[model samples]
Target chain A: MSAPPNRPVFAGLTSAYPRSEELVRATRDLDRGRAGAGAVETLYAASEKEVAALEERLFTTITGGYLRWNDLFRPIAESWTGFSVGPLTRWLETNTFFRQPVLAQPPVRVPGTVAARLPPVLGQRPEKARVLLPGPYTLARVLDNRTGESDGAVVARLGALYAEELAELRALGFGTFQFTDPYLVREPPDGVLETATLDAYRTIDAARGSSTTIVWTYGADPTPALRTLDRLPASVIGIDLTEVEAASLPAGPEGVGLGLGIIDPRTTLPENPVETVKVVREAVRRRRPSSVWLGPAASLDLLPTKPAEQKLLRLADILQALRREGVA
Target chain B: MTDALFPTQEIGSLAKPSLEELRAWQEKVPFVDRLGPSGPDLLRGDAPEALPDLRAAFAIAFLESAGLDRVYDGEARRIEMYEHPIRQMAGFQFLGHVRSWDSKYYRKATVVEPVRLVRPYHLDEFDFVRDHARRGVKLPITGPYTLADWSFNEYYLARQPGWRGRPQRWAAQREFVVDLARQALRPTLKALVDRGCRTIQIDEPAAGTHPDEAALVVEGFNEATAGIDAEFSMHICYSRYEALLPALLEAKACRQWAWEFANRDSGDHDPYAVLRTLREYGDTRSIGLGVVDVHRDPVERPEQVADRIRRAASYLGDPTRIWTNPDCGLRTRRLDVAYDKLRAVVAGSRLARAEFASSRR
Candidate 1:
């Protein structure tokens, strides 16, 4: 199954593809003195080979130029969250984990922060590289806020720091950025914090200049926060439709794009392609979004690598089926 | 200053491997850089105690070197908080793997048969610490409620005679927990007490995670410690303490409370915000203040920790009801980092102890 001729549907990871447990086990062997460090490289190289194969099977030409850069994993963000990123923090209400980016002082852009540490492959499709980073407000929420500043102060500081990092990524040739903020959806801002959070996103968006910014929210429904998020001047808004009924999605802003995450990364159960199409069609029909994309409801990192891989394969088949139906 | 605040005990887990302990594999795998050297060995059971003790010795050494007033074997004998207990309990099988935060997975177990203790789990480790410890050692037992909360209840649920509804499910869950409390926690506490163990901390992280089950948590604690005499504690973190409160007041008599504070200390978020409820309740339960952070490996300044103790004391309106500790376990850190952080915990505790004692006089 494939898209309509000359159709423009894009299929890609909204966040980092999972690092396989085999690679982790191999790395563990290196750590335990049972194997040489080169073993890790060998295994990781093989893992990347599989990732390349999956990308080949699933992604479309509209997304062909954005393979390796399309999904910058947690290591990049954790290692470069401008502070000594803390130990892996558990995602509340779920079984998944993330190495929390500690906000000791304001997060800053040091000389070699993330952008400088890019693998050689990141440069190949530099023009269309889609880089993922924690959004300013989300980053602030997870931070070990060392300063006794107000939430607004923390948000502004984080927004400025994220701006600096995004600007650096932009300078390094990354054009599309997905700033993830799951907190906004899980607990929409009320009263004064809402205004501050909105202002903070505006500051971050302004700093990116011409680069595309897709502010993504997961872990909760985005319906209530839609109005506030729409005013941020970002190019796109990514919604997690896993929890909310597709019928409940609001008719959104005219110019901003909408990406509906229809795939469930938590389980290996095959998603019905027909039902998925209906969800997408309804979102498009109701929201009248300027542009639309299909992806998973949240970071695929939450799943074990096997389930994540299966979900990706399933997603690929569904997209292929959608394409065969000539419904881009 | 409301009375005695002299002792400082570590919350549990002192696992920090030095860089030298890591294998000679580097300069290769780009992704391998994220994992610390405390990798595979972290999931296994007690390596036969090397010399005086294997993993326990290093932990005791650090706490001792830091000059803590109380200590433990640092939970070096166990793999992690959940499975270590589940492994020793009969009728539970390794069901599958579950994430222990992120990336890291713990072997999740389920009871396919009736629950029973294969043997006393904590005594051997406790004996080692008891022999070598310079101060009082606290043995941390994973609480009955947490053991029930974390595990899948195959054993109890299957035996229910009819259609399993919400109430039946709840009954099955409670039966499994209380059964474990009778078979595991109570017996363990009795054995430890019989061995002259004076302080036992029942870790109930799951209690705080699910507040709706607070009563069961308290029930587990009460049943586990009934007729058994010791300085007991209920340790919890990353929870909504509000839900546990009022109810937590009931169980405070059986044991003092040890909680994580520093890691949750978000500037204006005020880590000590819960002390108000504690103060309002007027039950003078000793509060274990987590002065050191376990979330990050960064060693805090000694003064930073001292300031935290002072702040906790001030808010509780009583200087004497406080104890200094790390926010949680130190298992994820590098060895040197854990040592340095504990040193900070000790130093900071000393500074605050002197100031607090003097201020009261």
Candidate 2:
């Protein structure tokens, strides 16, 4: 057979910069004794500036650069107007904190709340932008079970809300959408969480029409639930190769695209571009991929700004390396 | 306020302004500029030329403004919780920055050599507050397990063994941390006791970060506080207190356990839900109830604090077993927000005290 197709790599699933920037602004505001309702608006404005600066910095890079939901507090519950945002809460494993959106009440997507809040600089470059989210299953996992409902019951409700959120983004012309399930790797799939997640993916993908929908799984092994993940009606599915043995990857449909999280984001150890190319190349050969995307196994929220930035550059280098090697 | 009701106190480092605030203060304040780039560094043992002792005196006065039954220096001189202690100890050196939570980081130190005391770290800082304080003063020190928990174990990774050729890294943390508690903290506790520091609060924010490691934490606390005669109090924030309660009860040296109940209350506004958890483990240790939510800027209503305390009292079955405090430290908040939260702590404690005393009559 002809040389395997060289995949596109997106190096922008980064949480290091804007969250850091917004945190600095919160610190500045708090330091200046600027407390109360007005500070929230000011924080949002400062966040927009951070976005503009982030876009301007990443504008020259080849692979697509993302405009992140930097101030996204707890995953799903923050969609409601009443779920007031709190301090930068601790993230599991990584040293980074995300403004965890607290889901207190039944989540109803208030108008203007769910819309993408990119600053004009990135907002102008919609082609390069893909809206990413903490998939419904992951969002519902962190939520406290205050409602006395089953996990499936709560997940289903959140799934519907996520579908709505995705539809809104698609309406705004965000053609490429990603829903990341970090918890998929962390928690063994309770049957209900998997089914609810698949349903949510189908609802969003079907509603958004022929747009490219990528369900990127990371941080834990989805090996047990791979078939369920692959069966979801989406254009592409990303698996974390860090958790999967390259040789044992099962054969799959050539039509469904592949996104390999070939680089580890949790460690300070630098990645070898030559080795990264080999990992994806092997997966492509065995799986017979239609399309391939290379990237870090998860969000680069674990690394500090300097290292996270370097990891993004290194990811781009791997793509260039594969292109030169021909069997890409 | 009735003595039978639990008394309120301030936790360590009550929202010290971010270094950003210190930089701002450095630019404006004439005397603090001489202390260094960060004005608060003066509070440590290393202040240049002993800068007139004004800041430590002000720390006591600032806490006195809150009217807490017990007060602390609010850790004005040191950096964030873990770094200050590591800086004072030998063998530990800053390798680089590590993320603790979202965007917040503490300098990750590696214990490359055997740890020893640079000297007694908290005595002079404690003495200033003790002499100047109008309220009873509480000196808060970083507990050893938390110090080990937040650190990168470079030394232990090399030295400790699980079996043949395999270095048991997890077990290594236990030994290294227990060593830090038993041997490392001895000098500071002795020095503080010698200086007549009666109330010692061990700040263990990392105590419940990992639920499985709860037993190790208790072991560390017991080792760290051995033979020090002062009253021992412990502070833990944003953890699964349910998992920790059983293991933490083993820290008999720790007379009271302070928790961040108000901080837990943030996501769910349910008033009774958190105290409901506290009531689950009945009558083992004096529970320090968090009435003020320190993470948020909004000042708590006094009635809300009183109501939370009353609910805690009913469930735990003794009002006296309860103590009052803010959910966590005020370090990341503004000075104004920090003081206001303390005011709520005092005001709410008053409300609860009055209600309890009247009901008894």
Candidate 3:
């Protein structure tokens, strides 16, 4: 499960890559009633395959690309009982938006819903493939909880559902599960951080059997929550390097992996490999943890297709350079 | 303009014509055929040259029928708000499409060098709209703050490699926005004013994206329209209006704050509570109140629109300072839906005016 000496593993964050021009056109046509759902699904499948191929070459861990997802919460919102997709809310500060999940009642996991939403395994080794989900804390923060339950209760319920989803995915042969918690860093709710948040992570960690769990936090600095996040029972803790300095990062608990977000996905400006290497080296030198996962600071969906791919290529180059120098 | 209690205007941009709609318009207005043949290929966007005049004529006709007091040609000649201005400006290159919401995307660009206007970008569109329109025209221009926030800034970032993180980002953004105001937007506004443009609406929907940079938005607005001789208003929608306010109060050159409320507040109860934030911040400028929700297909009842205006008026304490409009542009709606929405606004405005006159008696 460990990366080889002096080499850091690379992976995509929670979301899909930006849709290609052909896919964009197909989706648009479907919106305009010029094309059918089947036509758009065909394009989605094609796009997922293209992304899987690219990730297979550039990343140590592969992703399903989540091409069918309109937003992070859509599949769960649509499939799960007692949850409905609401109006478009801006996703953090980015131009992109997600349909907020509105809770009518306590959520119930409908069997095969998460499985059906997942992409068909596109020829990658099963152990190297990862599925991304919104962490319970983030899901609780973003959702309109009309269930009339306390925030803690909502987190606990969502945590149980995510755990079940992770267990099912693990049985289906995925080896890595990344729980994205952008809201946990951006705006953590009162009191839940001390109790429900940590318990939710524990619930998910207990369910993930022999599979690696990554808690990726982005869109804000995680310095204040680093110690609390380090105590979670996850394998790796990802922080957005674009939002914080390398020197500011503290070392995590022994044996916990470090997900070093070296590339910024929001900007179109290409990263200089040398400058990225310096950041990785400085971060590694300071927060010398058990392992390293080098990747973009946030979802690549914010970028255009070409720039998103170029960023991965640049990350690959940075990883190679790091390996050559025995930096990690 | 009509001497009404609440004037009605659209927040620019009607729906672009479908091929069938274009053909129908050509048949109705025979002069449209003078521009080019009404063919299917024209609707595919290949014949931008032949379509602008026809499109403007159709839009003006539509607005005239809607009976709004203040009207523009629905920005028919231009592309979507962002790309239309950025395409004409120097030092920017179209990168690719970025999603704004579900199934909706815009072609975003990168700032490769210092940004400047290539020419008067909106002159031809303005001239066509002015000559053809029967009502008073209100032009909507993309503001510099939005242009800087939306684009990828390489030129500004490249200037200060030594500085790092948020400080560097803020500094570069300030320089880029101010430069855009000085070099591009100021000239465009001045030219529009010189060419007899009366009311210019500077659209800056990205103003509240960064709450910390609210002052930056105000600075950009003030810088762009500094010496321009015209009535300048600002239209910001689907944003954190509360965050932009206190800071937006600093925009001295801006005469009105045109903002969207109907989209967020469903007009059920105390729908204009957000308007209280403007009053709290001492923003006493004229308010372009958004009473129609443009995102939905079902037409809001004239009573609902009037109710919204009445509630907003209670907060402003002056119906004369309020102008009624949709939450944002109707470009997102179908053509029929957009027409119905505008007609509803006009009807609602009349109803409110009648109520105000009765109350005075």
Candidate 4:
């Protein structure tokens, strides 16, 4: 599975960045893990170890850049719901292909399969790419029917399930997984759902055979939420630049990757590319992550079909440029 | 004056109607007016028993004093959610609600599935407003295209209809929603028009949601308003108006584009930057410039509001084509805050008009 011949010209990274064979190998390795809590959290724990012999072996076998971003277990763990997950997972899988925009019950997993399917559609995007899954809180908020259930019950069950699935992905081989929990901002000031979200991350951390970065995208008005955030075992927290004023961001995270989402994923308006590069550079100067992954606040689901394509191209351009600057 | 406030049939006061109560709802005095540390509109759904009620007409005297050409009962009779009555009806099915990221207020609404329109305005809801409303009232209703665009369509009609069947259910659904606009909304507009209601404001918050899909919705709206000759208006705000920018210049069914000039995307206090964007389209329709801020509030100074209006007039290149308004609907604000905000808008418009006349001399 060599990279496709028709891969679009990207500006930032090396020409070899879009290697299809490497992506396929990474996908296969990622698919081999067990489908439970231990597998998921162990991935998170293993991610925390500093480039140890064992960690190097795991990252090397996974192709490259494995322990970088958060939500590594998601694409794999959420997929198991195919047999044991909620009704939405079944609906999404049964009706549409992984990336098809139809809304069904959203799946409970990371959608690694969707990631694997993207190279062909995206024309061999960066090899060993990172895929993002909705964070626990956002999942809880949007999927909740609130008929007879409390948010904690939902988080606990899903967390246990996520932990097992995340551990499985580590065993299989995923470079980075980004978990997005935007709903913490929407949760009641002193609510149980917020507590359960942190608990779920801890469960995953304890279970993963090794350390992995847990990324939180779209956390804004980050107050009260950020108070408890640094304590969570996850590695990185992705903040939304479009939603939260950059001034509101905390001074620094101890060792977490600062996932800065500078692009607007929801609207079709093209971002000024120069301004985008400047923002990323400033964040690098200020936050100084061990690494920084540039992307949008969320998926480009709401954009029109054509504009969505343009958005992906723009993002690819940004990432490529960042790689040239050695930031990724 | 038509006797009612809303066109629907579910007449009842969801909240008390009072001019003074509407004036006090702002969280801040001048800047940062809408959202507050304690939160805005938190005291609703509670009762007040202590203060002796003022029985006279003087209590509401400020409403007319504010100088609104057309006024509403400020929707005092209705509660927070606007679409509840439609949802409570037998046929409409419930879909989960969506929240505005900026404002925590939730709009609980239903998806009209299987696509059918049975009747016009709920006669029951409109009758009371009809009886008690002031003269020449403006009637507000959500548009049809917005309803279809907001909800998820279970079927995309991807399947081609064979010999016994028809193809492209999406096209059919689009037509269905438009037909609903014609059957339900159009008649409601006509009823108001027939009753001597001179101005009707149709609120289409969802219009800007999908810019590419806008032209499709506009066709339906155009059909709904074909040959009807009342002063027609469309109110939209808190949105990036760029999507519908081209449509505003087409001079179609709407005679005025009543928009929020002081929203997050529109900029905080100064609306000139936003009004300038619509400069090229000024000749197509009147600009319902929101001179007063509605979100947070100390009432805007007459000078500040007047300044905004003058900016709109300059950018629009014509003072006559610019109308004064608040950025968005005041239903979410406190009653007192809303009244004060409206007062600033009226006073501001007067100052702008006076300035224009002096300049002519």
Q: Candidate 1 clashing pairs?
A: A1-A320, A2-A323, A2-A324, A3-A323, A37-B25, B16-B335, B17-B335
Ranking by TM-score: 3, 2, 1, 4
RMSD of 3: 3.9
Candidate 2 per-residue lDDT, tens place, B265-358, comes to: 6434453354555556554667778887776788888888887888788767777888888887777677777777888888888888898888
Worst 10 residues of 3 chain B by lDDT: B27-36
DockQ of 1: 0.08
Residues A1-328 of candidate 4 have per-residue lDDT tens digits of 2222222211111001111222223333444442444554354333323212221332211212232221223333335343222211101100111111111332345434534422221212222334344565555554423234565666666677667656655554544555666555534324676678778778877775544555554524455566666566765666655544443455555555566665553333455566567666655555555555555554433333244345556766676666566442
Root-mean-square deviation of each candidate, in angstroms? Answer: 8.9, 7.3, 3.9, 20.7
User: Best to worst by DockQ, what's the order?
Assistant: 3, 2, 1, 4
- Tens-place lDDT digits, model 3, residues B1-361: 5577898887879887854577765454433433346533454455657567667777877777787777787888778888888888889988888777778988988888888789877988888778867788899999989888888877888776842465667788899999999998999888988889989999988886676688998999999999888888999876667666688888988889898877656312254777787777677788889888887788988988888899999887778889999888898888778888988998988898899999999
TM-score of each: 0.69, 0.73, 0.90, 0.47
For model 4, residues B1-361, the per-residue Cα lDDT tens digits are: 3221101111011135343343342222221111233222322223342111210111223344455655444443334324533543233443322223211213333333444445455343344334443333555566666554443332322222321011232464476557556665677667666666566666666665444456656766775676678777777654557766676455377877777665432222243665666776544576677666555556788788777776666676767677666776654455567667777777667777777778789
Give each prediction's DockQ, rounded to 2 decimals: 0.08, 0.14, 0.40, 0.03
Interface RMSD of each: 7.3, 6.7, 2.3, 19.4
The lowest-lDDT stretch of 10 consecutive residues in candidate 1 chain A is: A61-70
For residue B242, give model 4's deviation from the true position in Å: 2.6
- lDDT order of candidates, best first? 3, 1, 2, 4
lDDT of 1 by residue, B37-107 (tens): 54234323334333224346556756776667788877877878888888888888763454444335555
Better of 2 and 3 by DockQ: 3
Better-scoring candidate (TM-score), 1 or 3: 3
> How high is the DockQ of candidate 3?
0.40
